[model samples]
Target: MSQGDEQRTAKVEPLRKARPCPECRRPSTRDNYPFCSDRCRNLDLSRWLKGSYAIPVADDESKADDDYRD
Candidate 1:
């Protein structure tokens, strides 16, 4: 077999997981995994940049007590 034959046979499996896109719920591509397309990916990024998504934080009673002591 030629080197070309060996090269052709050697294929790399996709390491990225294939799942539904978070933004559009469409099948994800290898290039834009977790998102279906550039548009969807960009939209998600825009939302993040715009502070549309917020992380919920719980008020720690212990921290609050310490603040009052000082």
Candidate 2:
């Protein structure tokens, strides 16, 4: 291969460093990323789909009622 072709085909490193998989706590893979494998990735998705992960909201019933009345 020519020098120009080599330069064009050279692999570029990711700007951010790889982090450990959130589900398995193993080194993440380039293919799966954020997760070590498809299993871990799907597990996380399953949790989200099943409502296992949720954002907490503070209950303010009085405030909500006031808004509706206004």
Candidate 3:
């Protein structure tokens, strides 16, 4: 390949740094490596179980409240 062609070759983007586990602040593994192990993952899961994680459930009646009634 010509020098210009080489220049045209796509540059490899560096992978972003792995995020640390919320429970231990330890670097997470590619395959359960970051948490150090599944135990850590479960520890994080427990937090969610105990109300650490919450997803808002929309109230069905709220939509009806906005509807016009005959």
Query: Candidate 1 on 2-44: residue-level lDDT in tens?
Result: 9999999998787876799998899998788788899999999
In model 1, where do residues sit more than 4 Å from their true spots?
A: 60-62, 65-70
Which pairs clash in model 1? none
Best by lDDT: 2
lDDT tens string, model 2, 32-61?
A: 988999999999999999999999875977
lDDT of 3 by residue, 1-70 (tens): 8999988896966365678876688777777755757999888779888997888775897777677552
- The TM-score that candidate 2 achieves is 0.72
Candidate 1's error at 45, in angstroms?
1.2
Q: Give me the candidate number with maximum TM-score.
A: 2
Stretches of candidate 3 above 4 Å error?
1-16, 49-51, 56-70
> Could you tell me how far off, in angstroms, the CA of residue 59 lies in candidate 3 after the best superposition?
11
- For lDDT, candidate 1 versus 3, the one ahead is 1
Clashing residue pairs, candidate 3?
27-34, 28-34, 29-33, 29-34
- Please identify which of the two predictions, 2 or 3, would achieve the higher TM-score against the true structure: 2
How well does candidate 2 score on lDDT at residue 18?
A: 92
Name the 10 consecutive residues with the lowest summed lDDT in model 3: 61-70
Q: Which lDDT value does model 3 have at 5?
A: 91
Tell me model 3's lDDT, rounded to 2 decimals. 0.76
